[model samples]
Target: MRIKLTYESLDGDIILPKHYNYHIQALIYKTFTPDLATKLHNVGFPLGKRRFKLFTFSRILEKGIPTKDNEKLIFKRKITIYFSSPIEDIVGNLAERSFKEREFKLCNKKIYISQLEIVTTPKIENKVIIKALSPITIYSTLYKKDGEKIVHYYKPIDKEFSKLIEKNAKKKYHLLYGKDAEQMSLEIKPLKFSVQENLKIIKFKDTIIEGYTGIYELLGDPELIYLTYETGLGNKNSAGFGMWEIWRGKESDEDA
Candidate 1:
């Protein structure tokens, strides 16, 4: 399920950390019941050695602009966010709390949910166009010559990018349905891409992550494609990465 959440500040301006993904994630956890929150935080659904939180959210969207320095983002009035998950329980918890508790603390600023709506799910097919609402990220953990840990982020065009995404999707499928998705096939083709321009650098607390945003063509099994839509593509999805929406071929195509 996917939902659109719009928040309006009670105060004049809404202030947030420039890198606010961690705050957004914290807010999401706060919405859940304590038991649910603890479960998701301490122990999510397990598949082998890895755990899947199974939820993803889009970047905060706001029309008003304010000053931006090195540490904070201040916006006037309203902001919109998109949240999605294939698990009905997870979506239910978020929607229920968000609606019941109209007011929320985004960082230290206070805001209220002005509107909450369930976004209609688009039909998935073997071939579809998508645009990232949040940057997509995939990476490999490695050790340096000195035995220090490092992360190597992959570009969209890198062979590992699509391969890892497909592999990750299957793992999600297994966790969701308790069935192996080895038969599912998926491929990602970049339709609009530029490394210098599309690359996004984000900070989650002290850790830095790199991701990309662009239009892409997805060719795959319909089920797996939908899974990517709900659970997000690539890694660090729960940290507000890899949320996407189907792209209409033209502006007027919405009614078609």
Candidate 2:
């Protein structure tokens, strides 16, 4: 489910750092029941053996007038948070806690949540073009001559990245449904992909990781299609990566 969280800046303007996904995750955890929060965070489930996040987010930035302290950033007072998971409690608990607080902290800045509204109309299809609200991050390790390992981050558009998306999708499916990961039948083909130069970099933990946000047309199982959209398509979805929606073509229903 997608939620529009309207926040008023407690202090003049709200300025967030690049790769602000960590901060948003923090807000949800603060409002969660201690036990539930621990489960999602630790993720002892099977898919989590490799540590996959089950949620993604839309950018939480609003253009604002620049202030002297931070001339580079505009004052932003609003943001939208998106949550997609098979577990009802994960979604329900966060929604309840957010409503209760009504006002809370984000990125060390205090803000009041004036409004919370659902913004999702789910449509599922076997083959659909999905648009990313958050960047899709794919990671692979590069082996050097000396047998050292180097991790490389990739956008979904890369030729070899489809396997990464497919593997992650199956992992998530198995993790949630308790299906055999090796036997699951799933296909994800990248029909089309668009890339932006610098907007996809994410700050994960301490490192600056780059990713891409755009439209991708992928063909797969109907259940997988919806799950891909819900659980997010790529890495760090729980930290705001690979969140998507079904792409309705330019023609409206009336036009169609």
Candidates' C-alpha lDDT: 0.87, 0.67
Candidate 2 has an lDDT of: 0.67
Which ranges in model 2 have alpha carbons more than 4 Å from their true place? 61-72, 145-147, 181-199, 248-256
lDDT leader: 1
lDDT score for residue 102 of model 1: 81
Clashing pairs in 2: 55-237, 64-75
Candidate 1: stretches off by over 4 Å: 63-70, 249-256
Model 1, TM vs. native: 0.94
Work out the TM-score per prediction. 0.94, 0.82
Tell me the TM-score of model 2.
Answer: 0.82
How do the residues 147-170 of candidate 2 rate in per-residue lDDT, one tens digit apiece?
998889865556667878888888
